[model samples]
Target chain A: MTSTNHTLFEDYLRGYISDEEKKRLELVLDSSETEREEFDLYKTMRRTLSPNIGNPYKERELKEHLEELGKKYTHEFSNEVMEMPVVRKAGYVRRILSVAASFTLVGLIGIAAMIPKNTSKALAQAYVYSSDSTAPSRSVNGDNLITSSEEYYLSGMQAFKEHKYETAIISTRKAKVGASPELIQEIEWLMALSELGLGNDAKAKELLTEISTDTKSDFSGEAKELLEDLNGIMHRISSFF
Target chain B: MPTAKTYLNGIKQTSHKVQHPDQKYIEALRTNDMILVEDIYKNYGQMITDLVKKNNGNAQDAMDLFQEVLIILHRYSQEGFTLTCSLKSFLYTLCKRRWINELKKKGRAETLKVADISDLNFAEESKESVEGTEMYDQRFRFCKEKFNLLSPGCKEIIQLSWRKQEDGKYCSWKEIAEELDMSYAYIRKKASQCKARLIELARKDPGFKNL
Candidate 1:
């Protein structure tokens, strides 16, 4: 190709050329196999240089996420298997009833029996926790009411596990209202996930930003992971569409 | 006798029905569905581990290979890739092939025992898909490295030109030039020159020829 043709090719690839110039360049490429080959290479290089394709930083983050998930599952799978039979048997009754009349009684029983003794342990096994410290367990009210902040937190976790995220958000927000400062961070982290589950990405992101900015927050590691995960998911969803 | 038009239409129809069962897995990977990913590990992790171990590899190698395959699938899914067979079979084929390639690279190909993989038919399209992903990844790394090597001014100009807003429109060169306090023609020429330099640097690598 001539020097002029090469410059035109570069200009065309950079999208700086006029329509007429593009047409002229295409005509030249269409007439010569060698020119066409060079044009193809230029086109491929342009695409490869684009920030959207095969981003190494995003790829690294995803790899780390997958590795963490693998490790967590490997450690938890055995325990989950042992617990599965018991959960299945007890969970059957909860699945069968849908009536409002017995709802409160069932919820109490579910919280009593369904909420495992080490509920936090189960949550830790199943999900990445932002904080290393566990929330102190408060006694459940026998009157089937959420009285203590701890009960409210547990209720939110239970609803979250059941994928009832909106309810989880409400209960978890209530837990945050009068909780000790230590527990407030944990509540905010769970509330972020609840917001994510409800497809309230902006709200979830806001919560994550708050958690991540608090240097002393025990949930910083988890908050960072969720924040990156949220960004990755949003980017992928946008790209897919 | 069928006409040429009918024959071409038949080919198109056959291509349309080549949907594979692993599409859901691909979608799950793209969406970063942890539950499905964990399930995949549960279902196929042992098989991959055994396959790697039986072929002079270890559990760690198996894990690495599995993650690499998933990463490749994730990358390809972004480019509108489709599966043409069961995910299990496709994954097994990819993992096995990659393991063999690794062995070859390490000069252990002579000692490699060919496992019986008659049941796993690696389709032509699947092979192309794997190769294409590898090529794209190779080129992407090369371009990224070269772009990073450019002067700071060049890098800044090139990046600004590629920056797209949330509305999917690129930031105009006029705006970029104004922000940078440079002439519009200079910015455009500089971006093109930086890109050309990147392409030139990438081409200097022998691996680029193969890609």
Candidate 2:
């Protein structure tokens, strides 16, 4: 190729070529197989050199997110399996069942009560507050004993309040093995709520299923109600198709 | 087979079909839907863990491989890749293949068993998709390595000219030249020369020829 053609190719690769120049270059490339091959090679080189060129910020964000996920999975899998006791508080049972019944009614009525006019705007409203129910405090014994799992659980709760749902779930999962049976319910519930906030219906459903099946837990009724609501939503979404 | 006219008319008449199931999973990754991510782990975690353990690897190794596979999928989707199979199958195959490679790298190839993969039917399209991603990753590494070897000035010029702005525009040669306090014409020539040097270096690599 001529020096002029080579310059045009470089200019084209760098996106500096004007429409007219591009047309001329296209003609040159069409006229010779060698020029076309050269064009292809330069195109490949440009693509290879800049894989994340368009969204470096997004790429960096994704890398950070991946690192966080790695830490979460490592912590979750590395913990020793502990035999959990099925401890239930009689005082909380009635309140929990009442809350569950209310939620079940909401689910049966198309979730209109729980869901606001704007679904995205309703995420913050869905935060599961400890004060929402008169249920006995599992984490608030007189001694106020704290374990590493409880610390992680509290941190996870803080993260949830900050709308960092992924961090909340990770931290809560890290608390799983160390938490007492009573605290386990709260941790699982919060983790499920975080999942719901993040649009992970399937995951949220799975957690809720586990919670509902553990009838001994204070959150069992509430979990069953939430699972029904999730099912309702899924059914509605699928039917929209 | 339908005739060309029939196909064209049908295309005009019909609305788009339901999205593939895997598309939802892809969207979950893109949007950072942690719930979906957790569900993915719940569904496939044990299978992958077992595979890794049985193949002379551990849970940590499995997690790493799983995360890497997800990253690859995310990257591929960002580059306009579409999945043709169920997410479960695709993920399983990708993780299994990666774990096998990892084992082989650790000189445990003799212990690698094919029984796990025997029942997993990987579609031709999926195989091509994974291979294409692998090739792109290789080329990207090779190019990055060669580009880093260039002079500082060359690197700056090339990066400035090629780097995309937040608004999706490339910085013009004039802008780059002004930023660097160099003449536009001189900067243009320098960029071309730098590019030529990079191409020469890349060409010298044996893998580049194969690519």
Candidate 3:
């Protein structure tokens, strides 16, 4: 039950009172049904509400009357929708369409047409987009890159997860198409897997050694194990031959 | 013994621990990162605007909250309080608290809990404080309207002279003449006239005493 000093409820953790104090206080207020009711109200109010407090802010922006909050905040946003596998395809489709349209516009503008001329490349680009292409690709760059597709690479990922290593590698290789050298790490892993499945032990060892040297993670652990297996096989083959 | 290089290394370690946040390329009114200030605006701006309307506030009231909310954040971070919750939830609560405090300060007596604020979290952190803030903002808007109804020359004089201090939370009057492009003697007389007019408006308002 609440005392007349119900204002404590305004503070964080309801002032963190002891259970004995709480019970004694409740008993005191319980003397009157009205007091008990007030106590209950405070208790209920506390439960229903969250206790975190204080304002969050930056001095510079507040002065300008909400000038660029939207632009600034979007950068901090986690890109949750893009992260979900279900929505990722949608993100890809949106990116590709946007990119295609951008390209077509760019191409036509090069010819000095202001009406946003249409182009076959744009149409082709849109056709192979994730939504219509059924090739299951994603972008190598951030979701904004549309002209070059990551559809085949994404398909490789799906294939590998399905334990179809050869197909996955093939798909991964296609994914690397037109990609910057800064990229290709993810696709290269898949490509190495393709070689391993095709019994190309030497190539697999080379790829595994390179990846493991650059970084170490759960994936690196797997590559190391595979390297050991292939090295053992090569030793046995040499001895027998 | 850690000498000049050692002390420098210690400072470097502490700096790394602190992540030396970036403050480059500030655009006007952007507040997302250093204090998690930008996200606060995005998540709460609409809610505050809506709350104002629901409780007899106008778009202008909504705009004021945006400025005030950002100001409060600046104050809190400058004081070095850790933010343990999402920006959305934190901002909602602060605005609500400001509204309630403002109303209470005005002496409006319907003893209402934060419950009346639908936007605020009833359990305190479950949701943002839109409800509570809206309630208070509604009253502040009422106050703003009353302030606006005063003589325009008076209003213009007051606003032109109004300056947000370093912290941006407290408003005070100083050098009104410089701000208004007038002389000290002229400002003194104009301020007196403005004060009386303001008093009369407050007297006539039903919510003024409560406010």
Candidate 4:
């Protein structure tokens, strides 16, 4: 079908066309089975893609709800699988491996304690978003609408607020790619906060440095203050060593 | 013979059987009923996790596939699709097919260790439902893929144009044009051209013929 007819058919399907236009479109569609088929496809697409009718936001919520349920079930499933006799029976080699694993875990805990921790996390607890934080507003301006990046960024922020720091970091990193400069700043700020939430103080400090040094960044002022606080926390922690 | 309307509506029906008892699952999905949804996981979730785990996948993969399948089912349910077969058979078949396709996409098709499902012997009605849902899922994915490829401006315009206002009316092109700081004619033409491009892309796809 011609592009004109395609648009007309869409308009008719969307109820954007007048009765005359609808009649004209129907006459054109009546000319061939192919036309009708193409029109039907458009109709299907409309039915499927129409935001109000399809209620994509609700679909997303449902998907998230399902993901949570899936996670819970799979966690239980994994536990059940682990409890099976075949998996549970330990041989001599397995017993030895377990002993070594215990020693390794103890050594790792000692090393982790020696490393400065919790200070950054404490600092981040203040900087990171809470349930009281306002939700990200929808981008109304067409020029600013990078839908995927916006979606990822929003999800990242949501994860951050929920204390899913690892998920927040992953999502924010994805949002960083191909994002606008302004969005990149927001993403970087969130990433730094997520790193701090994860207790990766060095990574958080590095991200904060980048944002603070960028004069044009919206988060520069806050990042700079957080960097100073982070430094003081590190300084106090290092004094113990 | 099923015409375009039948295809547009849903899968062709061979029988007017009573709706399966498990139709509640579909309804639960549509309404986002948490109790029934959890029951879905309680009853059949293990089967999917086991299926994925045995086929070089982890619990996470199973979880992702499970969510995708639920979303697809929910979309079809919204389209008034009826459940003639048991939801278990339908979900199992759909997950198996989707996992295989996912494996292919990941270049692990050769490593797909899923046992031959033919022996399970899905009835004709279940097979039909699974196929129809898969087709609908594919078409939805295709449309989204094309929609994402549109210019950022076009995407925003199309999104805003189709989105309903608080009062339950689609935002007029003129309102969208003003919001986007563009002339009405330019906005209208852009929206039309954007939709045409999407349709044209779908039409040009060789796979669309079978769909």
TM-scores for the candidates: 0.51, 0.54, 0.28, 0.55
DockQ of 2: 0.10
Error of 2 at B188 (Å): 1.6
Q: What is the lDDT of candidate 1?
A: 0.62
lDDT of 4 by residue, B61-172 (tens): 7778988888888877765667878887787778888898887876666755555434155434488788878777787777777777888887787788767776867777
lDDT of candidate 1 over B135-193, digit per residue (tens) = 66676676667777889887787677666566656677798899899998787677667
Model 3 earns a TM-score of: 0.28
lDDT of 1 at B11: 19
Give the lDDT of residue A229 in candidate 3. 50
Chain B TM-scores of the candidates: 0.69, 0.73, 0.42, 0.75
In model 4, pairs of residues that clash are: none
lDDT of 4 by residue, A1-241 (tens): 5666655665665578797976666665566787888777676566566652335677888878887787567657643442111225569998999999999999877866887554655667677644133245546124664578878998988877777665677688778777877778778888888878765565578789999999998788889989887778564564333
Off by over 4 Å in 3: A1-67, A72-241, B1-35, B39-122, B126-132, B160-174, B178-183
The regions of model 4 sitting more than 4 angstroms off are A1-7, A15-18, A32-38, A51-55, A81-241, B1-18, B102-125, B164-169, B178-183
| Model 2 misplaced stretches (Cα beyond 4 Å) | A1-7, A10-16, A53-55, A77-241, B1-19, B27-46, B117-119, B122-125
Positional deviation of A3 in candidate 4, in angstroms?
4.9
Stronger candidate by DockQ (3 vs 4): 4
Tens digits of per-residue lDDT, candidate 2, A1-241, equal 4434444665665567798977777766666666665556666666555545434566566667766766666545533232212234467787889799999876756745443333321332353653353222345333577788877887887777766665676788788886787778778888777777554555567777998899787788887766665556544444232
Ranking by lDDT: 4, 2, 1, 3
What is the per-residue lDDT of model 3 for residues A1-241, given as tens digits with 9 covering 90 to 100? Answer: 2222443222112334576765555555546655444344333222211111112223443555354553343223311111111213357788989899999887855654433322322221222232222234544555675534266777766665555544565566667887555446655666666555433444556778887776733246555655665556443343222
The digit string of per-residue lDDT tens for model 2 on B1-211 reads: 3322232233234223233567777776665676786677766666665566556554566677888877666655554555556675667667777777776775565766445223235423256555656765666677778888999887877778667776767777788889999998888788777777777777778877765
Best by lDDT: 4
Query: DockQ for model 3?
Result: 0.05
Q: Which ten residues in a row have the lowest lDDT in candidate 1 chain A?
A: A78-87
> Which 10 residues in a row give candidate 3 chain B its minimum summed lDDT?
B19-28
Better of 2 and 3 by DockQ: 2
